[model samples]
Target chain A: MNHLFFQINPLEGFFFGSGKAMVVAGVAIIILIGLGLWLFRMESRLQRLNDALDQRLNDAQNQPS
Target chain B: MIQRSWKIGGLALLGYVLCMIFFVPLGPGLLEFTSTGSAGHVQDQDRKVTVYALTGFGTHWTESPDQLTVVLRHGTQLASLPLIETLDATHVLVGMDLPYTVPSKSWDVLVTHPVDGTLLLENGVFLQDRFIDEQTKWANPEIAEYPAELPFHFPYQPQILETIRNLMLHVPMWFTMFLLMGISFVASIRQLSTAHDLHQDTKAEASVQIGLLFGALGLVTGSLWARYTWGAWWVDDPQLNGALVTVLVYAGYLVLRATIQNIRLRARLSSVYNLFAFVILIILLMVLPRFSESLHPGKGGNPGFNSYDLDSSLRAVFYPAVLGWMMLGTWMYHVRLKASSIERKLRQLQ
Candidate 1:
């Protein structure tokens, strides 16, 4: 097989490599996780409020008066 | 039961997204392939000759330096060269002897790590003089054949490197945002046509609200990616500005909904405004950014320029990421819709 011909240059760029790239990923993941948890808690709270409302409505219907 | 199914599908998608994103292997390839000198220093058979080769970080190099092998390929001819030493995770010293004339000028350096497999550094090193006269071009016999069943991995990119994985998270957020907003646009159209169904308006509101959340995520992640890669948290790029404007337009829709006193008036006005905003959103986010000069790829001269191009191995993970996030966004929109309905019922009781 013919050897592929392409230019290979030496790596150069100071401190602009994998470490900083990972940091960007880390911060983004943190934000997504935090926001997801917040949304989960909010949904749970809303569910509880809706259940309470339903219970109150049921009790009022059962009153003799 | 239908609602329950939606939740199940959404949860399943979320699980799949997490597994694919985290578990894929990087595969055996060159993390970094570079030579210390432009042309390998001239070799004198009588004296010790050494040149440096640097590998990228995260290269699997657990084996001792002796276990590593470096081969030089000139056309079809192959020569196994000795490494003087391993400097660190990134550097190696290669010693070459010109016993035979190198067949071609385009010589390649092949580094075989004990476990990392073979990385071919092509066209970087050269011989000082021509020794061999015959043209002996053939495949290098020394290159190691890797196992066929290597686990799936994100493709290694020259500039992005590890951050290439970020494509799964950052790019998908925009896809999810676009899908959710598209749904919202349809719901607003329904609100206008129907006899002002409160349910449709609520659904539209909920979709935009969740879509905004995803848009916010896209912007933040994109900004972070730019900060590391482009060396800035924010740039005057059209795509970035377009995304911001789309999010703000949706936000304005929410504010408009909040301020109105009359229910019919609010629903009517908001739906009309939503239709206009959705059009502007499409124009700004989709159409305008493609034509302008932007650092983002797939724009102005960079046709599929970035690693996110259609043929990328990232598509395996990225398509699923988009589907999963869109599913999650839909699930959130549904939850918000139900919550709003419940609130309305409770208000009636008051």
Candidate 2:
């Protein structure tokens, strides 16, 4: 195996073999980050929308419908 | 309603779990059998065949007066077998009978060993297709195309494997964002027709909120994917650019909503402004990147690289991610409504 490396390129082995593992890990990280941010931002938006609506309604009632 | 919610949620969970159970593919796509000796390919009909009755690891052959029977088969097609004689301790001498001829084509030839009364080989010989022409003693040699690619094969078909776990999270962000923006679009439209529909305003507000959720998610997931795949937090790709533009447009929607206070004017102008933004959103995210090529999955003349992106193992988890995120989005929307109603009740009390 050592002698095979001396004759051939190191990227050749990784490009074919363990390179697959790299792609798998790389894509997984991408997906993970997307999901986490989605959850967090959605959560905050839901809260903000409710608060803003309450303030608007309060201001409306104070002026009389 | 609370009890029903629990039951419905339980049933959905059960159904999802059951779908995962049918994941195992069961069929005769693959088969294996053990035999006393290695199976040999059928060269032709006239070739003398031997059967060994095994005593141990090696078979002990006996010469019998009974005529050796041979059955030649090409898949289901049965052909006449050559007559053979049982000679010596092991070998049978087959006599070339009735002009021994067989079409050169890969066939699952079935040859039975007489001694053990067992199938010798299921796939005895694989032959190449070459019709033997009578005019030429040799097979009619057509100029065959030099076998282009040896055979289509997989060289580590590298794609999102467990990366599919990201689907649950990454893909859902877009789903949520799309859902929220869609509602906002509807609310703005409704406000135009129904002069003073506060409900529409409420919906519009809710929609932008959810859109923000999705936009943020898309960015995080995309950035994460960029880091892992491209070894950077960001890159200038068409699809990514379009997604960024869509998020920015939604952010602008929020800014526009906050700046105006006249409910009637806000509803009318915000609605008009939102309509334009969504039109731009569709053009930028849905249209432009598609005309140009994109690193994102679905773009370019290429239908996109998702053939291997989603495997069953990942699909098992991905569907749940979508459901969970969607349910969570609905939950948020519902809470917003509740808060709206509570405020209404409190005002009536006042």
Q: List-wise, what DockQ does each model earn?
A: 0.12, 0.07
| Model 1 C-alpha lDDT per residue in residues B1-350, reported as the tens digit of each score | 78556555655565555555554544444433344553343334446454656554445544566677777766667877766556665556666554555566556766777655566666646665567566555454556744323356665544454456567778878888888888988988898898746878888888899889999999998888787668789999888898899999999999999999888788889999999998998889778877787878778643234544544457766777778787778878877887887877687578
Where does model 1 exceed 4 Å of error? A1-65, B23-50, B60-90, B94-150, B300-313, B348-350
Give RMSD to native, each candidate: 7.8, 14.5
Off by over 4 Å in 2: A1-65, B2-162, B301-308, B340-350
iRMS of candidate 2, one decimal? 13.6
Candidate 1 has a DockQ of: 0.12
lDDT of 1 at B313: 58
| C-alpha RMSD (angstroms) for model 1 | 7.8
The lDDT leader among the candidates is 1
Provide the overall lDDT of each model, using Cα atoms, as 2-decimal numbers: 0.68, 0.52
Measured with C-alpha atoms, the lDDT of residue B117 in candidate 2 is 31
lDDT of 2 by residue, B166-216 (tens): 445577677777777778788788878898556777777776776787788
